[model samples]
Target: MIKDIIANTTNIKLTVIIRRALQGVASNNNPYLTLILQDNTGIINARLWDVSATDIEALVAGQVVTISANSLLYNNELQLKINDYQVLSGKEAEKHYQNLVISAPINVEKEWKDLLKTVEDFDDAILKKVVLHLLKQNEKDFTTRPAAVRMHHNVRSGLLWHTATMLKTAKEIVKVYHDREINQDLLYAGVIMHDFGKIWELSSQLITNFTLQGNMQGHIVLGSEQIGLACRTLKINEQEPIILLLQHLVLASHGKYEFGSPVLPKVLEAEILHQLDNLDAKITIIDDALKPLNSGMATNRLLALEGRIFYKHEGEKKKK
Candidate 1:
């Protein structure tokens, strides 16, 4: 696994998928291949020195290869010094595909089943129908796609893990505000639908890049449009109360206009959805940052957290 690469590990043999491949030139105009390799656990960077343009273009993303390398740790970055590598293809690549794909640790089937059931149990009939219809329509991608290209939940099945966790958090929050008459159905539907368009926004599991439509319109716009499409398909008016509210939640869930929300959240449920969504994504960012650090060591600045660094303590408290 890429995660197991460390300073003292002198030499290793591994099979991984090429997540990215690019050619760069040095001052002398020597061509080198810059490669981002990925496996189930994590990813690592590597350099293929003295490579031709042909080598760089031929090694496209999503190609599986086995490498023989000596670990080189330089300036706090670990890179593979490739002594040799062989591209695996046909049946051989298929054999390693399952192990190389990064995935959320959650049980995919159970989480997916429960997520569907949550929608099915919604007391609001209109909300229930729209959410279930859209979710089932995109079940294949929603169940397996990554939530992002590189942020929190950037692994296969990460979309489910992030959404499921947010759903659970929203459920508990609804109970806490029991007397407030908060719309649990709307909040829950918002959580699920907020990022559902990512199924089309991001590339397939092997290489998680933004599609042209994603780069142009983004998930928020795409999701809101998806809701509008669903309403039309079900013969529900786009201006119907529930349809409008759901679309609004999807639109304003990013919270601020600066963050790409065209309008601020006017509804309480939309605001709550924004908070919970940000909370989950930020929590995952922190957890992922702390992973490779030792006690008393601080992480490098994280752009995801506005360039703040985090420290890992010696030990964590046990759950009772």
Candidate 2:
């Protein structure tokens, strides 16, 4: 698998799904295909040099292909130089497609049931009703969409997995501060709604892209707008304090103006949600980066992490 690859690894044949494929021009005016390849393990950037127009037409994101590549360390990142590739079709495509796509590691049905139970148990009746209403309105998409196109929790049903894990983490935090009078119910609702807009922002569950609205307004704004819709649907006044709080949580979840959400978190729950959101997302990002490195090896600078390199401390066999 990709995680075991090192600088000396060469001439490997890998069956990988193309997560992204872009054609670009080299310095010498030659055209090349820059492909982001993914498997169940992790993702890597690869280059198919000197490609013709037919090659560009033949490749696309989500297409499964078996390729012969020479692995090389470029700028501290392990990347592939594809010498050749063949697209998989029919039974072969079907077989690899099921096993290759990155997915949530939890049982979907169980998570859904548990999530609903937690929401149902909320002490704040109005908050519970609004949250349940929104979830019911978008259950199918919420349960199916990836949290992002190519970042944290960018896998099948990742939104649910991410939200559930964050909720679990928040629940523990609430317990820790049980004596502090923090409104645990508000925290729970805020956590779930923070990334709620991704379901609508992302174009599809498969072969995902940003919707026009998603690109224009972004998920934070898109999600905040939903609070208004939910209020109208639930016959709650938009001016209610809880409604205002939920909207703030949704809009300010990003935590910074440059990050997209211009409004900084004002309420305690919004602040808590922002912190947990970053913790969860960074944890996932680091996990994904470390998965493709050998123990004691360091990854290339990760753009998402502000060009920081991370090291893997233990290997699979060592852990065993």
Candidate 3:
């Protein structure tokens, strides 16, 4: 049985397939493969011990190979010292290596249906029509697109999943700011189409890689272009289309220049979209990082979701 390196202790033999091999230096002189081994539950880092030229030649990234290693904690993080390793060549590799990734735990179809219900709750016809068109245009891709290349919700059906969450939050905010003339239509449009560019930005597999277009134009540019084209095809009113398109711009840009936005959010709706998106992304990072920790104990450290460290919620511990 495959065991997670995270829970493995000394002398515990684990049968895990090496998933990724990252090169790094050890002890300032030795080269090592900082590997990531995965099973069904989770992935953890492992250190390939006693690296030699011959050993390095036998393994390659993405190959399913058996590893014998001893687990140890370094700086409060779990890691394994690989003792012996070999690539499972041919059929064995094919049987163990899974390239396609679609999370089965989450009920994507049910979640999408519920999301549509939330969209239907909106009384505005124009906003609904715009959303319907965008969704229809990219329905196939959206259903299977990962939200990002490696960050939050990077799984099949992730684009829809993230969009649905953002929409639900935006709905609550709309009710609060209804009288402010915040343009609910634009707000909803922004929420639905904000990250649609991600469909092209990332590879749609268990291991996502950046595409040429993704590297050349990035999501913000690609997403904006897509919205522009959809707007023209629908022949939406010029002013309304501009506002709707700006909604996606706000989401794509997030806030500052460093965060990959060409321009910062200037409008009230745009500012709100940035804040909501930031909040959701940060929370997701913290939540996913802390999943391996025991219920009551605090985690050692978080690698900062958006360049900032996060402390676990104290309230969750009390309740537990």
Among all candidates shown, the one with the greatest lDDT:
1
List the candidate 3 regions with Cα displacement exceeding 4 Å. 1-8, 11-19, 53-58, 89-91, 97-105, 117-127, 235-252, 295-297, 300-320
Which candidate number maximizes TM-score? 1
- The residue-by-residue lDDT of candidate 2 on 50-137, one tens digit each, is 9998899888987989999989988767889999999988888988886787778888888888888888999888888989999888
lDDT for 245 (candidate 2): 88
What is the C-alpha local distance difference test score of candidate 3?
A: 0.68
Q: Candidate 1: list runs displaced more than 4 Å.
A: 27-29, 317-320
lDDT of 1 by residue, 1-320 (tens): 78888764656898999988877897788888889998888888888888876677667898999988878766556788777788889999999999889889899999999999999999998899889999999899999899998888999899999999999999999999898868999999999999988987998857889999999999999999999999899988889898899999999999999999987899999999999999999999988877765678777788989998888887854337
Q: Please report, in order, the local distance difference test score of every candidate based on alpha carbons.
A: 0.88, 0.86, 0.68
Candidates ranked by lDDT: 1, 2, 3
| Candidate order (TM-score) | 1, 2, 3
Which lDDT value does model 3 have at 223?
A: 78
Choose 1 or 3, whichever is better by lDDT.
1
Worst 10 residues of 1 by lDDT: 311-320
TM-score of 3: 0.82
| Candidate 2 backbone overlaps, count | 0
- Shift of residue 97 alpha carbon in model 2, Å: 3.1
